[model samples]
Target: MNPLNPLTPQDAPTPAPGVYVPGYARAKLGMIAAGLLLMGLGFSQFAEPLRLLLFGERARAEAVRVVKTKEGLPDQVLESDRQVTAALEPRDRSYTFWNEFRFADGQGSSFEVRAPVGSQLKPLYPLIDEEGLPTTDLVVYDRAHPERSAFPMIVSTWFAPGMLFVIGTLCAFIGSFLFYWAKKPIELPRLPPTAPATSTEKD
Candidate 1:
């Protein structure tokens, strides 16, 4: 008996119950781990260089394995071996005690911070700084980050927006595995053919 309320050919399962269980379980765990690592990446984005340090150390190897572009480009775009120092933009954009309060004059009276916003964040590939600045050996690019301390992980590759597709692929693989895992089937013994249907004499 078909269990689906609206039956379809695509909904039908394979002849054998062994169609897809084990692989799904393995990939599911990997997908979950990937998701956790992905979340950790967003956390790193907001927290300033923390995500870089963490993801760089943890998923760096796996990340490098994934292609970043249509022609299989790497995330680490290198312009040169130059190192430059740049200050962070003080990313405490929050409702602190003063920020959360409203002034009687109806004007926002939060603590004003003096931080330099860079004109351009170009040519920096591997290590994006605490201020999301990149590290490349370009002189014009270094005017903002003149301090020459390089974040080593910047050159390690696998740090970019496109890596999300890699994560999606992992999810698809996980889904394929699960599709077979939940499948079940029934078996029956074969009935022997009746012997020639002989007629009885007594009527």
Candidate 2:
């Protein structure tokens, strides 16, 4: 053993390359796929709201009446006296209300449309006027399909989509980070430098 070089050939063997873990790779791919699917689902939920915002026509429609019904039950007219009690009812009770509106298109063609979104608790807008008659409210309808109309309310238009968008965005970000980390090149431990061999000669 050479005193000048403490490290021997046995001590400096090259490090073996990192081995691929099938389970880890599969997990990474699954995360990425799930994130992408969530992003697509969330984005697709915005289609109707975006369509109404961009190409919809705004008009005043008469609040003809409110229909109150329970799931799997016949619809009944929501009376003004019962409005407050109904509104205060718990959401788990499954009672819901839909507002019916009557409006005319630019061509003077009459159309009656129901609100696309139903309220589980209370009516979205007031239907009665000071004189105790049905009143007019703002509605946004697709010009191409007036039958598809909705009240211009935030909850009906954007609340659910916005929540989904946020959740999807967060998931996509986490998934992307995990994927990048999983695909990063594995670094092998480096061997220490070996000293040059020296020879001694005798005369």
Candidate 3:
């Protein structure tokens, strides 16, 4: 090698043994905690769906009325034209729309319940009829608690739980990977052997 050239692999100093990074333990614990928290939340969100699936009674619910409310505002009724217009336009503020459904329980008790989930853009469930009246929608309510009901076969019913589960699973995988990485010993690349110097003989 030329004397003026930069140091090559053979000339470079040996790397130190890998050690735990500062705050790595704390980071690992934090990731694990966050993952578990999210997982718990995801599981909690699934409770209603699971309860409905196992011990729920299906019924045809009539929409009593559609209520719209902005975040942090009182609920109010919106005209169908206004609702459609609001849905069509870009959202400038957060709004929630839900339908109040009236249905009878197995014991012939009347109960009015709100939709399980609200829509940000438009009212959920019970499509409007030609006469501008609410249509009938299927509702699944817990057998023991008739008031606790949800609209089955809708995306909103499962969206929260599904998203939470996915995010929690990803976080858990990342946390596990970090834990394994933290405990495992690190290895450095081995240096290649240098060629022996050649001697020029007198010709």
Query: Which numbered prediction scores highest in TM-score against the true structure?
Result: 3
Q: Give the candidate number with the greatest lDDT.
A: 3
Prediction 2 global C-alpha lDDT: 0.68
RMSD of 2: 10.6
- Give the alpha carbon lDDT tens digit for every residue of 1-203 in model 2: 43322332332323235322112445666777777777677678777757776789888898777887787878787546356455445656588777778999877888998877777767665678778777787777788888877665647566776677777777778777766655444454556899999999998
Which residue ranges in model 2 land beyond 4 Å of their true spot? 1-23, 79-92, 129-136, 185-203
**What ranking of all candidate models by lDDT puts the best one first?**
3, 2, 1
Where does candidate 3 clash, by residue pair?
none
Q: Assess candidate 3 and give its TM-score to the true structure.
A: 0.70
Error of 1 at 35 (Å): 1.3
- lDDT string, candidate 1, 1-203, tens digits: 23322222343454442232122344455666666566556444334333333432211110011111112433332222232112211342221110010111113222211111111232223344345543222111111222211132442223442365456556656655554453434343445888897788986
Q: Model 1's lDDT to the true fold? A: 0.31
Off by over 4 Å in 1: 1-24, 43-110, 114-203
How many Å off is the CA of 32 in candidate 3?
A: 1.5
TM-score of each: 0.23, 0.67, 0.70
**Backbone clashes in model 1, listed as residue pairs:** 44-51, 84-147, 85-147, 126-154, 127-154
The candidate with the higher lDDT, 1 or 3, is 3
In order, how many clashes per candidate? 5, 0, 0
